[model samples]
Target: MGWLLLLAAGCSEIVFAVSLKFNDGFTKLWPSVVTGISGIGSFYLLMLAIRTLPLGTAYAVWTGMGAVGVAVIGVVWFKEPADWVRLASIMFIVVGIVGLKLTHAE
Candidate 1:
């Protein structure tokens, strides 16, 4: 359950991050609203997640998810660079996320 909440939080974090790009420094209307909502939602979910999960592990995984998710979105949706080095770095973060999850005990 905590892991599930963490996952949702991670997804919200991604949305919050992506929305920042469209918010135009909080000048935009809809995008800025989305940014505010998702950012708060992500933090709330993370708080709920930390209630049951280890704080350090949950925080690390949550941040790792946000980083990897935004990087992928940048490459695919924004047509940003998809160079091998960047891809490999993303993979490493993914590996670390997986490692943390696998090692965690309920």
Candidate 2:
């Protein structure tokens, strides 16, 4: 349950981050609203997860997932670019997340 909440938080973060680009620095209405709602929901879930999971582990996974997710969003939806280096970096984040989960027994 904690892991699921953390993953959801991470996804919410990604959603807010992508919406931020469309927010036009808060000039837009709908995107801005989406960003605000997602940001709040992200933190709420993050807090829920951190209640049971170690703070460091929870935060690391949350941010790691969000980073990878946003980067993929950049490449896929925004066509930002995805060479080998970028792809490898994302894989590293995935490996790190796996490692953290494995090492954290609680």
Candidate 2 global lDDT: 0.95
Q: What is the lDDT of residue 43 in candidate 1?
A: 99
lDDT of 1 at 66: 100
Q: What are the per-residue Cα lDDT tens digits for candidate 1 across 1-106? A: 9999999999999999999999999999999999999999999999999999999999999999999999999999999999999999999999999999999997
**How close to the true structure is residue 87 of candidate 2, measured as C-alpha lDDT?**
97
Model 2 pairs in collision: none
lDDT, candidates in the order shown: 0.99, 0.95
> Please, what's the RMSD in Å of model 2?
0.8
**lDDT per residue (tens digit) for residues 1-106 in model 2:** 9999999999999998889999999999999999999999999999999999999999999999999999998999889889999999999999999999999886
Query: Looking at model 2, which ten-residue stretch has the lowest summed lDDT?
Result: 72-81
